[model samples]
Target: MSEEFTYATSEGPNGWTIWQVIGRIDVSTADEAYASGEEIVKGNEKIAIDLSTLEYISSAGLRVILRLNKLAKKSGHKLTVCGAYGMVKSVLKDSGMDVLLAAKESLDELS
Candidate 1:
């Protein structure tokens, strides 16, 4: 069976957009997650990704996030990830993406 992933976007403080990702963000759903994030960043100067409900993520997902970070930099936008926990945070930390993406501790910390 194919796993389903859901990603939703909303307005954040100071008009920044927040993309709340739910479900597993693995190889099967990485593209959809990336596309959703891309659409939010297209017109906004700041974007936050909420990983509170995200259960799993793979290398493909990390690659997508890295690509988004680069795109955000070139477009003069800010990209931050919030609420990563357990294995999700471990993977990010292990891959050194936690540093590269500048993933923040929490939304409150960013505020």
Candidate 2:
């Protein structure tokens, strides 16, 4: 069987671009995740990612977000993550990404 990795992009307030990640983010989907993240970074300054629906993630997946954050920071852009819950939240916390990833409990906090 094959697993699918999917994401959606939408515009947010104050010229922010929101990307919603879905499904498992492991080695199987890390490459594609990076490609999509790269595409989102182009021509955008503020980006927010919603991980509310993401079921799982691995180290490879974390690398993708880390790279995206680095690129955004280098360009003077801000990247925020919101809506992380369950194991996804735990993963971010355990990995110390809860600090490094700029994750927010709610988008309202960012506004």
Candidate with the greatest TM-score versus the true structure:
2
Off by over 4 Å in 1: none
Cα lDDT, all candidates: 0.84, 0.86
Q: For candidate 1, write residues 41-68 as lDDT tens digits.
A: 7778888988887888899889878888
Q: Give lDDT: candidate 1, residue 51.
A: 83
**TM-score (all chains, Cα) for each model:** 0.92, 0.92
lDDT of 2 at 85: 95
* Candidate 2: stretches off by over 4 Å: none
For residues 10-63, what per-residue lDDT tens digits would candidate 2 score against the true structure? 888778888889997899999999899888986688889888888988899889
